[model samples]
Target chain A: MPKILIVDDDPNIRQYLAALFEDHGYLTVVARDVAEALQTAQDERPDLITLDLDLPGEWGPRFYRALSQEPELKSTPIIVISAMPGSRYAIGNAVASFTKPFDREELLKTVGETLDL
Target chain B: MAKTVLLLEADSSHADALKIYLGRKQAEVHVAATDEKARGLLASRDFDILLGNPYGFGEACPGEVKRHKLANPLLQVIIFCPRALMDQAMDDFGPLAANYLDLPLNSKALGLALDHAEKCIATEKKLAAYSQRLSDLHDAQSLYQQLFNEVPCYITVQNKDLRITDTNAKFKRDFGHEVGGFCYEIYKHRSSPCPECPVAKTFYDGGSHGTEEVVTSKAGKQYNVITQTAPIKDENGQITQVMEMSTNITQIRQLQDHLSSLGLMLGSMSHGIKGMLTALDGSIYQLETGLQKEDRTRMAAACEQIKEMTERIKKMVLDILYYAKSRELQYALTDVRELAETVVSMISPQARHKGINLVTELEKDLGIIEMDPNWMQAALINFLDNAVDACLFDPKEKEHRVVFRVSPRDPETVCFVIEDNGTGMDRQTRETLFTLFFSSKGSQGTGLGLFIANHVVQQHGGSITIRSELGEGSRFEVCLPRVKTDHARLNAVPQPHQNVAF
Candidate 1:
């Protein structure tokens, strides 16, 4: 099964995405903060990562740096989710970008199409 | 205003001599040689002091002195007696006599007693007048309170510390249940005092101030209150208390909001439509020119753009109609979970295109919340739109998502929480979020979304709250009561409003 990693401080969002990915026949790992996301990346070596630009403590560039340094997860596709559609970080150098309250089908399609599912 | 002295001595020789001496000292002196004659004279005039001999006709004359006192209670009576009779007179007359002179009165002692008697008389007269005036003032104060309490405005008195000292009848009736409560707690519905208080300024300056403020009741209903506070002062010009009159202006504020919103709606619709028309016209011109030149590709593109612009205009018109009638919410019993799902589904496509997650956690077997589905959808869409706007940025944050969760809070109410992991609002933005005509989006915002949402929620006996922190994200919570309101019945005939996603 394809492995997907979800990073978000909100437990509800993290749990919901995990359930969504698991239901769709994928192995899902959820991380509530940036530190946890880095640890999960090292251990699980997920196929793709979904990252929230806003994590609890170490947010924005700090989390991005942590993700870029992981040798095992360096080649893995990362999708950035943001509420601000016009923000500088929404789509800069990310594999895929989505706005909050995203369309479920399009998100799945992007993930499926990106991985050639 | 001339000082006068009346000597009531029955001894003819003593009376004549005393009269000559007092007259020489610039005092008008009248001598009566008999007690009966003196009593008759006293009945008709105002006297500064009355000098009398207690041994009138040698009849153990205590009765005559007492009678004189009864006639004029404030009369200063100085007894003149020979040294032999001085002790007897004092014992018999009690102390009604202010002082005594023995034998042949020394002119110096007599003159001093007369001056003392004049001062005593003046003080007594002034005190009597003052007492009468005070009684009259009390009557006037009671009458004024009656008039003040009868007015409709809420009146309250507070100390410099904002402690409620007293409240009038109207204030009592309006907020009597909250007596002895902190002024801010009772009036502003705040857990603590307001940060910026006009009452504080008024206290500092000893001046009157008027301002409009929003106050919340214990029941959580908000009121637009116009308050005026004036300093209550003492004779020394020190502010002892503050008199506050607050008038409920909630309805007036709502009307002003409605009118301004109506104006904004007209203004934006005209502006949007005009721009849409101009674009449509330009596209038409392009298509006509392309067709004339036999360029089929350009003509097709122009036609497509025109169609899109027209569709956009149509949507704008529908939004205006939806909000214009939001005051009258027609509602019915609707499944809360189903409604949330439907809204999520409708907005999912836009989210999917933007690559954001759309999710809903609807509790199963939840009872229905009565609300106007079309209006409610418009209101919810406002939150969804804000959520969408918060996440619409260049770097697609992977965890950018909005969640619509509904759970039964109680048998009579359902909790609907729509939280977005979008850019959360700051304190100031949250404060003015739902106020009519207050928008932070500048020209891009019509300021109608939250206002309309607030109105719709209020109509359905529900409440909407926004929780946000800067750079983190924002959450919108709406709690709807399960009991069907009259508004629900009116809106229940749901012909889906045009452009309403849910």
Candidate 2:
């Protein structure tokens, strides 16, 4: 099973995504902010990352730049998830983008392709 | 035109001869044989020339001629007497009489005398018309001077050098500067002319120009003014000076600042709303799955999150509504204890969730207080909510506590005190907490909480005192007058108006 990292500031979003990924036979790890997101991404080395654009302190793109600078995690696919409508183009190299309350089936299809499953 | 002559001669033959001589010169002569008859003729009619012999009236003729000349300065008088009385006539009449002549008049002499008198009449008529015009010019000048002094706006006439040459009464009253003062120095207290001067623009283009400016008065008060400049031209149509008139618009700009900030506040608030809505969706998703799997833990947690999110949304909506409308307090007699209790209840659950102890001490009977109940409760809630947030943000390992105390300070005052044993403000934050535009989201979490809270307290005729120690705790005491404010009395009926942001 491929592992996924959930990065969001909201606890409820983290809980819901964790439960959904686990039930779908995928391993899941969660981080509350940019600092935690970077630490967990390095420690767990998840197969994929679902990134939220807005956070309490640093934005998600800043975390993406930091992650890409790491030689080992440079190629890890990133899926952009955000409530901001115009955030799709914020990270030019994003694998895919999904707005909040995105359709579960479509998100799953995009996630499946990104992981090559 | 023909000149009219009054002839006074005792010799009828000589008078007839004079009439024939005067007629050839286009003069209509009226003959009066006696002095009384001549006086009657002079009183009854207007004559351009008076030709008479002074000896016939016995010294009365010269005096009468002088009196008539004084009454009508434009009338010409000619005295005809024998060479014996010519000197006396000349002395008595002097410049009053136009010409003097000999009696037993030679045809050439009489003809020459009439011609001289007629010439004097024409010159006097021309002088009279010129003098009438001169008086009319004086009246017009005074009328324009009155208009220049009475206009309401601050008007100044500036020359090419931007020096104030003249000012209206209003300008002198407000600026109180001398006429030769520099326009910049008088209006703006600046050493040099302003970069975007409307007066200068008018001088350059010879067309009216308008601009808005913030100027300082002589009393050091600032005024927002809309200035308009028009070129003051000379008789040859050359622009000599520019007349600048400024109307004070401080009140209008102040109102606009309030409204403009309101517009800006709404745009920033939408981001917070979006985040909350996304969390709401997450909660709904959990609720749906909890019902599907029959998981008691998921259902309970989902319900709690939903309740908290909804409560926050409801509060934010109320805050928006409060700020959106015009700031007219709807005063009512409210139970003071109830109002305090309601605020505490709303805040206690948050304190509990954050692992902070919440305590309340209220007088048994706080009595009924006159205030806007809704605004009063919102203000108290903000203070208490800040206390809980302070406790949550504290890095100390020691226990945290928040105490809300309500009591009557006097017969006319009720007080509310919120104290927290949590992170306290530094020296800078303490000094500038109540200062307007004191926004730095460090000590006060929304940055607007304390600002709006202070405003609410002041609106209710109240004061707020803050005490805090860094790394220890903070306390806020709000003392409000128990009776309605004078603002409420004057605004018994609120006038509806467009509201703006500050």
Candidate 3:
């Protein structure tokens, strides 16, 4: 089974996305902010990562940069999800970007394709 | 007029003869025989001409003539002397005397000398008057120059060729004091004249003209100026030069820009707000369905979503309140039914244009409510406008209608209800409807209308509630107290989000 990392500042959003992916039979790991996201990515080495742009202390872009620097985690696929408008172009290396209140079917489909690749 | 003359002589017969001859010539002659009498006469009376026998009066005559000349610089004096004594007389009194005669005076020569003295006095008086007038003109010119320089506005005098002839101190300070420079070059840094220049218009029509212009200074700073130009005509009544005066309005323009950009900032912020609303809606949808399924794990997860969305909404509302606190409300005792009728009249035309049926149902004698009529009217307009937009956005094939109704809830409260048969909101939308920046119209909505409408109603000590279904319609009820209440007490009412229910 493929494992997914959910990174968001909102605990509820993290929980909601975790439940959504877990219902689809993908194992889910959650991080409440950018700092924890970095630590979780190294420990779990998930197949894909879902990121929220706005986070406490550090933002998602800085975390993506740090994650890309790690030799072992450099190839992990990232899907950006944010409440900020025009945050689709926020990360250059992310495989896909989805705005907040995104369709659940679309998000799950993008996740499936990214992990398959 | 007879000319007055004083004659000094020691010989009595000669003095009497001379006085008779002068009197016949239209002269008033006063004879002073002794030096003492002559001195007295000279002191007491004004004489146009003085004739003295210097030999008879001895050395005192020359001294007396000098004294008379000192008293009246324009006085004319004639002395009688023998040819042998002429040289000595000329040495002592020549500068003071108008003329000199031989010891026995020739009457014709004496008359000629008196005529010359009268002409000298007339010229002196005329010269004095001309000098006084010249001094007055100089003073007036100085005053004009001072006023031109001290005026607070920039002023410049330009000739027919558009070259600056003169500039006031203020203009000189802003644009360097270079006379004969081209007006356009100095004022606007342009090589050629500006189009529709007020100064050029004044020159062509010979009438005053006014315009607004943005001017750049030598220091490279910009100023918004209102310029007025008038013709400066020459003595021939021809327009010779144009005088332009300008007042700076840079700060006022800056204030207007600041206000407009504030409006723009509010517009841009709506996009971020719309995204947040969508997220909240998604969360709520998950929560309600989880409850229906009775899944414990899903219910726990939905509870977390509820808490997070609630906190974000609270912060957004507080931010809106802080921004709107500056606008003071004007309150009056307004008839609720009349206000509703007025709003309907105002919006009916637009509703008809959109092919939506707008109807009003008012409860007669629905008494007055103390409220800000303008703000309350705006709230009604906002609700009606949303109703119209909802109808337009609806994709259904059914007949669309929006009805505005007003009635007394009780003796003390009035309720305004608006119902629209359009694309209504779902449970998730209804739950977060009154939260700031939540709009179903997507990019077309600023997300501020309903937020502002809710705020206005809240200020009137009123409450707003909505009931809707996904495809059927939505109904909004605004209940306001008819009697006046202390604004402080109204503010004490809990925030709107707490009162809203799904």
Candidate 4:
């Protein structure tokens, strides 16, 4: 099963995303901020990362930049989910972007296409 | 222009010859043989010249003509008399007579005398017209000067050098009579001229220009003013100076700032609301899957998430509603002791959860006070909650405690003081604590609680006194009068926004 990492400060969002991915036969991990996201990404080596822009500490854009700086994590696929508008260009290298109250089926399709599952 | 001549010679033959000679020179001569006829002619019609021998009537003739001449300054008199009395004519008339001619008048001399008298008449008329014009100009200039001084706005006329050439009464009243001072120096206290100056723009284009600026008065009071400039031009249409008028719009701008800040808050809050809505969707998703998959743990967790999110949304909505309106205080007679106890009870549980000790000094028989119980309780709770947060922010390993004290300051007023041993705010935060959207807790604070609390307390004729240090702690004392009409109680209120030095 492909593994997914969910990055959001809100625990409810983390729980929901984890359950959604796990139910689709993908193993899941969660982190509340950029530091934890980086730590979990290094350890879990997830096939995909779902990032939220508005984090408590470092923002999602910083996490995306940090990914590029790490040679091993440079190829990780990032899907940006944010409540703030103009987040599409905030992380230009992300595979897809969705604002809050996102359509569930559409997000799942984009994930499947990015992972080619 | 025909000159009317009055011939008072007392010689009929001489009069006929004089009238004929004068008529040839465009002089309409009227014969006045006696003083009575001369006075009648002078009174009935305006005559340009009086040609007569004053000695013909002895002393009566010259004195009457002198009196008439004083009354009619433009009326010229030519005296013709017997050779013996020509000296007497000169003595009586003085320089007031136009000329003196001996009797048996030589036609050439008489003609010359009339010509000379006509010349005097024209010169005096020209002088009188000039004096009238000069007086009119003086009146007009003074009237305009009065208008300039009476204008309500601050007005300054600046020359090309940007030096004030003139200032109106209102300007002198506020900024002092700063004529010959540099515009920037007097108005803005700047060593150099302001950039993008409207006065300079007006002088360049000969067009009126306007800008809004914050200016300080001579008394050191600040004002928001809308300044406009117009070119003062010479007759050749060259812009020689610029007249700058500044209308004080401080009150209007202050009101607009308040309203705009409210709009700004709403705009910022919308983003937070969107995120909350998404979180709500996530909770709903969890609930739906839990029900579909027969998962009891997920269902219970989903229920708790929904409840918490609902509470957050409800609070935000209420905050928006409360902030949008300047609500009137709904006063009720309520026990003051119970009110303090109720607020302490709410803060006690949170204090314990955070390992912060809660201390209360609730005095006995505090008595009843008339106030809006709903908002007043919220205000007291807000202060206690802030005390807790201040303690939480202090990461130093030490005992943390919050003290809530309620007491009656006097017969007509009550006090609620909340003090905390926590990471207190600096002077900047303390000064702007009650202003719109001023938050010290970063993302954790909504910035609305203290502002709303301050407003509610003020509406109920209360005041908040703040005293805080950088690392020591903060103390917020709220003193509210027993009644809303307690205007005299303000004299007893403490000095506000006291910051600790160092």
Candidate 5:
């Protein structure tokens, strides 16, 4: 099964994605913060990663920098979810973007389209 | 003029004798025996006094006396009743009992009662006049009280000694108990009286006075108090009291100050930023020119310079955004010193690259200030980053240095100072430092640094001022109001990257 890494500071968000992806026949791994997400991305080698912009530990710019600088995560087709005013989060690198309170079906479709699965 | 009396008697012989007696006494007498004859005599003539007999009467003597009185309550009633009938007459007609005499009346006793009635009438007129005057005075007093209480501002009556003698409901609500206290002590929280108090001037000169004074409450919150005093005059034109009204203007004054400073800063920043943009446009032209001349080396260098200059301008634009977003934008208590330190560290890399020594002197024992932490940090960063840039090392210089100092001005105010020992500003530049787009650094600086810095300092109920001279360096001072409220713990933590600067 294709694996998806869902990284968010909020526990509810992590749990909801985990349940949704598992029900949709994809293996899911959840990380609570940027540091944990980086570790999980390396250890699990997920097919795709969904990151929240406003994380508890490190915020928008720092999280985006962490992804671009990391060798393993650089080409992982990362998507950023933010409730921030703008739809895009640009730091040092390019990444797929989605505004927060996004629908589950849309999230899955974006993931499917990007991964071609 | 002749004295007249009318006698109505049933016996004709007695009527003739009574008429003769009255006529011999130099009084005109009219006598009528029958009721019909009496009515005919009354219809043709007016009589001042009526004398009636007890015997041969249709109604009783008491009833006869009452009928005469009913015709005129002011009329004098003299009853000619038998001595035995006097008590019965008094019992039946007490209100009409002006005087009673036995048949063959004693005129001396009648003369005394008439004198007493005349005195009573004069006393009644005087009493009526005095009662009307009292009612008028009552109406005036009620109107004065209504006006005093209904006024919008806090109003009070103060005696010559400056003691509040009376106060309205608004006065009581604002100054706690308004009456029975010194005006200065209650309103200004001052133990000693104010120097040259306007209210005192009114009391002494019997003239009105008004002034705006800064006052502090018991809790030490400051206020701009506007007081108006009008002398309350007595009938002799002497000032017996003073009426005072006060309104608090602390917030309004602060807001006005903020607006003026923001206006100045925005004006200067806009001018400086535009000037920098112009320079950037010039440099880009030069780069294009160099390329057209087939000078690859010069074009490459110009492009590098342009890129660096553009990056600096971009940073300035970000500073302006951060400054505008958080300057007095309202938030909970945040650790201002920690935020200052964060900015210091954030700019440390740049400081290191420029070979400038960067230092922070943040006081650990500092009160938390109510601020948006992200915005406050951004504001501090603008100052620090600008200072580091200005303190860049000259070719022959041993070491360039920039310093950041955060000190407590009591527990309620924190002072942050950013000083640099680079090529400092001249008088003209310092004067126009905060003017919009008025940068001295040409294309290199957007001139928004100090402008945004002033705005940030002002937002926290603090002030920002710059002191600089050509080549000596510049120092920017920021004063931030301290918070004594309960959100102190949350403010002390250093949260990273939530920095307000773009």
Candidate 6:
């Protein structure tokens, strides 16, 4: 099964995305902010990661830069999810961008295509 | 100097004798043997003196003297008459007669009278010149007065101590006619001189300076004036006073403010609208996917999401509408205690969701107040919402609570107090809390909530005040009069671009 990482500040949004991916036969791990996302990415080495731009403390773009520096996680695909418009440029290596409240099927499809499901 | 004289004598011997005697004294004499000839000579040239024999001319001598005096008021007349008629001729001519000499033909007396007549003529010419000069000076003084009073600007002369030494008619009528009053006291009602005052600068540098200031009249009317100040120096070149000239520019400032406010409204609303559209897109995606899968439960969830998002969009649209709409207020009598309870109940659900307690301590006898219910409710809700948001944003590990209290502040005023033990604002945020488009909450706030709330309170002829310190809490007090008056409504109408404080 493909393992996925969800990074969002809102608990409801994180839970909903996790359930959507788990229902598609993928193992999902959730992180509330940039710090938790970085810790989870290093530990789980997920196939794909969903990032939210507006986070507490360090933001999603800063986390993306730090995550890109990690040699083991450099190849992992990142899908940008934000409430901010035109936030696709937040991460240069983002596979796709989704604005909240995001399209459930579109997000699932993007994740599947990124992980080659 | 040769003096010109008109001699009216019916006897040629007497005329020739006087003429020969006057000729030796450098006199140019014209002798008329008849009354008609004397009238003809008087009309032909301006004579310095008229030496006439009234006995020869009969009763017409007084009439001729009156005519000549009317033509040239400075023309001196000497009437040679019998001693019995001397008093009568003097009475008829009044001040026009220089002398009434008895006609005995004494050459020495005649010579003395001629010299006296010449002296009178010289004095009359000097008096006429002095009268003309005086009238000219009067005209110049009147023109100066008109320029000072009727120039359509406020003019004030202040001494070195900032006391108003003099003011023009326009300044007296618009401000007050109080001389020897402090300029700041009369102009702005301030106890001290304003900081960096233009008048003070002119006095310091002895140069002209200009600045824009808001001046208030004695009756509390405000005016935006562009004021220029210049020094009034003494004869020794020492600055003794400063002259302040101000032109009112309230209307132009109002137009500029209105335009900028419209721009601010447009710029601030764009982000929230974009977020709402994206949320609507999400709901549509859910509906389409649920329909494709043919799942009843998923379709029901999608319908609920659509309904929820639609409500949010409607609220956002109404918020914008409320900020932009300028409408007449509809006032009704309302109970203060009941109003406080209703506001607390309305916001209690959100407070409970965040594990925060919402409490109300309303006085029993708050009484009924005349106000617009809709606007008052909106303002109260905004305060409650802000209190809740402050709590939600606090990262402290403690329980949050908000108190809504209503009490009578005085005989005439009723106050609504909202206190929250949440994340308090710093001084900078508190200072600009009521200004347009100033928001502390990024993305989540439209920055119009408090501004509109303050507007609603002012519309009701009330005031709002805020007290906050960092990490402590915030207290908002809205004081309103118990009885509404027409004067209050008239005074409360928001002026365009006026920076209104609670």
lDDT winner, 4 or 5? 4
User: Per-residue lDDT tens digits of candidate 1, residues B350-448?
Assistant: 677667787878888786776778878877877887787666531335589888788888898887788887767778888988876555442224456
Error of 2 at A45 (Å): 2.7
What is candidate 6's lDDT per residue for B1-502, written digit by digit as tens?
A: 4988888888899889888888888888999888788878888899888887756775776687688788898777888877887778878887777877897767777777888888888888888899899999899889988888887889999998899998999899989888999999999999999998888999899989999999987667678999999898989999999999999887777666655776787777675555555545645655666688877776776676566557556655666677665555788899887788788877887688668888888888888889888888988898888898787766577889999989999988999999999889899889998887666554445678888888888877799989998788899999988887654565554445444221
lDDT of 5 at A113: 83
Model 4: CAPRI class? acceptable
TM-score of 5: 0.48
Note the DockQ of each predicted structure: 0.02, 0.37, 0.10, 0.43, 0.01, 0.23
Report the error of model 1 at residue B312, Å: 10
| lDDT (CA) per prediction | 0.71, 0.80, 0.78, 0.83, 0.67, 0.80
lDDT of 5 by residue, B1-502 (tens): 1456667788889788777766765667888788766767766666656666644566644465467568755455566577887787777667665566676566666455544444444564567688889999889888878877777777878887788899987666656763688888887877878898888898778777889987654444456878888888889988888888877776567555545655665655553454344345435645665667777875775665566557667776676665443332557677666677678778887677557888878777766777767667767787787777666522236578899898887777788889988767777777877765555443235556666666555545567778987778889888777753333332222232233333
Off by over 4 Å in 2: A1-3, A11-29, A101-116, B1-12, B16-47, B53-73, B78-152, B158-210, B215-223, B230-242, B248-267, B329-346, B356-502
Candidate 2, residue B494: lDDT: 34
The candidate 5 chain B region of ten consecutive residues with least summed lDDT is B488-497
State candidate 2's TM-score.
0.68
Considering just the first chain, candidate 6 attains a TM-score of 0.96
Identify the leading candidate in terms of TM-score. 6
Model 3: per-residue lDDT, tens digit, B336-361? 77788899998897688668999889
Score candidate 3 by lDDT.
0.78
Residue B147 of model 6 has an lDDT of 89
In model 5, the Cα lDDT at residue B232 comes to 81
What TM value does the first chain of each candidate achieve?
0.89, 0.96, 0.97, 0.97, 0.85, 0.96
For candidate 2, the per-residue lDDT at B400 reads 91
Best by lDDT: 4
